[model samples]
Target: MRREIGKRILINSPENENAIEVHNLHKSFRLPTERSWGLKQAIFNRLRGIKGYKDQKVLKGLNFTVKQGEFLGIVGRNGSGKSTLLKILAGIYYPEKDSTIIVNGNLVPFIELGVGFNPELTGRENVYLNGALLGFSNKEMDEMYDDIWKFAELEKFQDQKLKNYSSGMLVRLAFSIAIRAKGDILVLDEVLAVGDAAFQQKCNNYFASLKEKKQTIILVTHSMENVRRFCDRAIMIEDGKIAAEGDPSEVAEKYMSLFK
Candidate 1:
């Protein structure tokens, strides 16, 4: 069966305009009910009239709008579809038909950290590679190379291969590079607190600066403290639908109540 995909439009607009507008957004995936051990087994199952898959809905008829320079937080439990919604907004997935998503201004998404890193490559080489993926020219990377390393506190590891780095180091390096990308809308997922306590302090300072500058950000996290601290508004998703929205404090309260 052919699935109809809805429209995702990008445009540049004035500061007063909404940065993102999502209407009737929905998404689903076809999950295999039975695993085919081999090609012959798959053919036999098909011949036996077994579809072997079921449709699983992740988001259902959601509607929301984010204004320019607003910091928005999305809170939900695991499997509640927060990441799926961010992926759809980042253009990595398509929504169902009749759903419309309109985005104004340039968007930078950090859905997965270190996505473009090569394990065999040196840190310096990986920096260039990741920069290229983010649309940065070699000259721009060169200008920021020292700053990036300084910020990540991995200046001595520049010549080391990425495979040798610890998980915390990798997250720090990726996050340092990601923040350098300039965009009107920033989409982040579970990246607020990374590395050791000192590193987390740095992240807090950086986010504080962004808040002070009125940067537009969409953050998906389970941290209600972060929601209250950084978000101008917040939304809570439950079972593929928006269960609560509005002021950050109210949404955070509603989210915490779900566990009780």
Candidate 2:
């Protein structure tokens, strides 16, 4: 059923057990007008009454639904609004008029590297901070603290500032925390692998476990292999709208055919 809230619409999923539902979603970004990068030029532009920005629509009218425990893959070329859609689903961005979004469960998103970590803080401190963001109490984090550090292989560096860690180390720690931060729906973007080959294998196994358990996951990635390997369904986005959606292999093939 679809209802309206002002200009926006609320689309309830047809599947009573859906994990996500979206209807006529739209998003746009306002970019500051480019001018000479100095206070003098800034003052000049303002004095002349030049419009200070332009709007770029990143997502057009889009609609979709994800059933409970579904592993859904999203794919698109660069600048196709795949990331924007993910952020909307994650509640980091709101849609334009008449756009609808619904999430039926606790959602945990690992959409970007270092999404919830403070660079100036020690790894240990950042862990607690991120845990809190995921709604874990300090006591609950303490119970799982050792496991998180151990998985990231940064037990010795937990006291070190995150800014000092290498890119690989940072992702490792972030990935470790995301896995431990359990939620009913998991949203990930281009994070299929991390660390060395051994760790990559571990990640594969972890995905397998999740698949077996029927965990609800939404992934955005360029890796067709991962999409085919893990996702039971997939969607291709083009120009901020869904171009195709259905079986994982079929959607992946359609995405590849665009190159041909």
Question: Against the hidden true structure, what lDDT does model 1 obtain?
Answer: 0.93
Candidate 2 TM-score versus the reference: 0.86
lDDT of 2 by residue, 234-260 (tens): 999999889999999999999999889
The residue-by-residue lDDT of candidate 1 on 72-164, one tens digit each, is 999999999999999999999988899999999999998987788999999999999999988799999999999999999999999999999
- State every prediction's TM-score relative to the real structure: 0.95, 0.86
lDDT of each: 0.93, 0.84
- Tell me the deviation in Å of residue 198 in model 1: 0.9
The ten-residue window of minimal lDDT in model 1 covers 33-42
Error of 2 at 234 (Å): 0.3
Where in model 1 is the C-alpha error above 4 Å? 37-49
